[model samples]
Target: MANLRPISRVVQGQRMKEGAGVTICRTVGTSMLRNLDPYLMLDELKLPAKAAFAGFPDHPHRGFETCSIMLEGKMEHRDSQGNHGVIGPGGIQWMTAGRGIVHSEMPGTTDGVLWGFQLWINLPKKDKMCKPRYQDYQATDIPVVESAPGASVRVMAGEHAGTAGPIKMRNPGLLMDVRLAAGANFTQEVPEGWNGFAYIYDGEGKVCGTKAQPEQALVLGPGDHVVATGGSGPSGLKFLLIAGKPIGEPIVQHGPFVMNTQDEIQQAFRDYQSGALQRPEDNPWKGEEL
Candidate 1:
């Protein structure tokens, strides 16, 4: 049995403004250290309104894959592949930054609220130089299973109950968006031994034999499954459940680039500044006429 590792702490995320007027929780991305190893960073971007969250400017990346899942609004994306489109509710844009590429994300709607999470998953050492690719999973592509009568699990990786996840990776990780009504109880195995965590997005619950109140994110040491139980009240319970194998390597991070060594990190920055990150033909097309 995977050790029943109880939650150690509860850290909540707070919003802050950044590039292009994007508002997001400053803490969640930085606090999830190794909760999902191989998957290095996660930023929860939530716009109070579409006008306020204009999205981000064109950017360069290498040695990582960006998993952008939209929970509320839409995000317009374009890349060097001449690919241009929008990913809305239940949608995901998995962009692999093997060698490198330039891309941009802009808000899709002119009205309404915009909310989503961008998770940066790490690639293995051997695949660092692989060519970049993007896999767009439509909302219909993801499977939703009933974890219980009123509780369900949206499996993104690994497995949950009898359903297998659609995503494939060089790493062993699991991303489950769970929702349970008040007074509901649920349980599931998280492999034999894996590092796991829970970020409560709404309502409240208990995990690993401990309580996880709203706005609190809990990190588990080592465990098989995160057994959660919700309470009876005016609110329901919702959270992000994640698990993965540890990379067990040195992490040298510089801004958006996450590598295993300080030298590699420096090289990444140099490549970007020296105009060596991408080829001219692969230059990402700029949509707007300035």
Candidate 2:
């Protein structure tokens, strides 16, 4: 029998505004939990219908990967590498900020609710300076499996019952988007000893014996399996169950830069300031205006 992992802690994300008044709920990257190995931070961005969401402007990042998943609405992405894309409902954009990259994410629509989640994943020390890359997936590209009536799972970055996410990662990780109808139940196993967490983005339910609701984050203990029960409501329960093997190394993070040591962090800052972050020849879109 697979033992169910219980929730060790439940933390409410702090609400804050960033990037031209864009509101977000930050769950990780806080004082309470600096990081969870390969994973650094998770932010939930939500904007109501008809309300203007002044999106994020150009920003720099290094030594990490960012995964953006859109649950609803639309978002436009433009990067310094001349990469441009838009993510709609059920879309995903996974960007690797190896070395560095400057990008902006803005709202594409104003008539409907905008709901999405952004997760930061740290890169290994050796691959910190690798070439930047992107793994974009549309809704149709993701595999959705109906485990049972009223219960379904969307494979975002891990394998489940032969369904795997399209995004390729330098480090191994799992991100599963789950949804359950009222009176439903779902159970699954996570890799033993892996750091695991689940963020309830919609509805209320019990995750691994802990009462959970929207905006709540559940940190899981060591065990093989996790159980989720849908709460008594029409919306049921919706959440992302994520886990990753801990990198087990020292991490030095200083505002947009996550490196292995203080010296590397300082070098990142110097490179950005001295215009040495990206060499002209390295740019794939150097001569193009984007």
Best by lDDT: 2
- Summarize candidate 2's per-residue lDDT along 194-280 as a digit string, tens digits: 888999999998898899899888998989888898888888999999899888889999988999999999999998887665443
Candidate 1 worst ten-residue window by lDDT? 281-290
> Scored by CA lDDT, what does every candidate get?
0.71, 0.85
Off by over 4 Å in 1: 31-36, 280-290
Q: For every model in order, what is the number of clashing pairs?
A: 1, 0
Candidate 1 at 168: error in angstroms?
Answer: 1.4
Cα miss at 285, model 1 (Å)? 16
* Cα lDDT for residue 256, candidate 1: 66
Off by over 4 Å in 2: 49-52, 278-290
Q: For candidate 2, which ten residues in a row score worst on lDDT?
A: 281-290
